[model samples]
Target: MTTYAKIIVNGSPITKSNFKLHNINGRAILPSNSGKYHDRYALYEQEIALIARNQNPDIVLEESLIAILKVYYKSEKRHPDTINITKSIFDGIEKSGLIINDAQITRIIVEEYYDKQNPRFELELFGESEYEINYSINKKSIIDNPKLYFPIKKNILKRDSDKNIDKNINSNKNTVTNKNICAICNNEIKTKDYMTADGGKTLICKKCFNKLF
Candidate 1:
């Protein structure tokens, strides 16, 4: 299904070169004005920010997506890298709360051509179920070696076998020390992807978090 948050920004087409970081006493950030390109990116951010503001993002994806970006150009000049353009587009989408994170996207498709009149971009999202790795299956692939994706679903042990379980758990509590792992499944985060819950410090992966809230 072709479903996505309807977003549109009207302005000169932006490019990756238009984005550059500036340092203000050791804090790095997007520069306000460094060149025409930088100025254009600044404008792009503003336009996107306005487009994303105040809209309730209701769609969540447990799998990856097909992001088809059709970029229309005013001239035949070589454009910046498509990857950079994709970044510029979705970073704003994530910040605006359209979805949990952009890394949830598995495939990116870019189509470039001239549009002397009405130069702009068209972005559409599609489910990536046909291509993305299945979360539960990938995680628990080893059937012989059992591991827990979440808390035990049932108490399978008899009372006698459960005697030392609490002690063993408390003894190795700190063995796996990355606190930012997914609270639900305890998996190491895949990328600089993933989002925080609405009003909590807990982190959740897209597959797990999308099922909640």
Candidate 2:
């Protein structure tokens, strides 16, 4: 809930699943083919742009950000998938000039619910530091026992894997900088309490590792 910007678009969100492809000069080209989609997308852009312009008129964010979207649907049956409906909303946010590009969004949180009388979605943006702090504070229990949220097999983190883990870490040691920085946060590793993920390709510091959990 630690958001820097928040907006609510009062309409059903559009999905990009209805895109149509065409042939131009024997080359395949895909385009959005639904007029309803365009209308809703334009509505989102206009509302976001108006709010952004009202605040600074020339504001644009290029830093890494987190987007949280809450969608309220009109019915419980045959609703669109959350993933399928994100593109148009993100594109609208991009077109609003509130941010230079949607590519700046490094994380996304989406939730859906039923709201028969008022179908709409709320969008909120958060900075990295704010999101990390808020998430850590609010989700402390989940982090403490990450295995509950992300279960692992009995043999995954056992003492038997120590030798293999050490070998992988040692082999990838040369890939890091002289300071041994964490690949995710770019912070120098000051203690031996660090580990690798993704087949030992990513070096993660203790703080970043805890955040992941």
Best model per TM-score: 2
| Clash pairs (backbone) in predicted model 2 | none
Task: List ranges where model 1 is wrong by over 4 Å.
Answer: 1-3, 17-19, 22-27, 33-37, 52-63, 129-213
**TM per model?**
0.48, 0.50
The TM-score between candidate 2 and the true structure equals 0.50
Per-residue lDDT over 4-75 for candidate 1, one digit per residue giving the tens place of the 0 to 100 score: 545555544576443333222333244334332234555575566557554434555445676777887777
Clashes of 1: 0
Q: State the displacement of the C-alpha of residue 203, model 1, in Å, after optimal TM-score superposition.
A: 37
Q: Scored by Cα lDDT, where does model 1 land?
A: 0.55
lDDT of 2 by residue, 110-194 (tens): 8888798999888787777666523442545444533233444585444642322232234555552345556556666677677
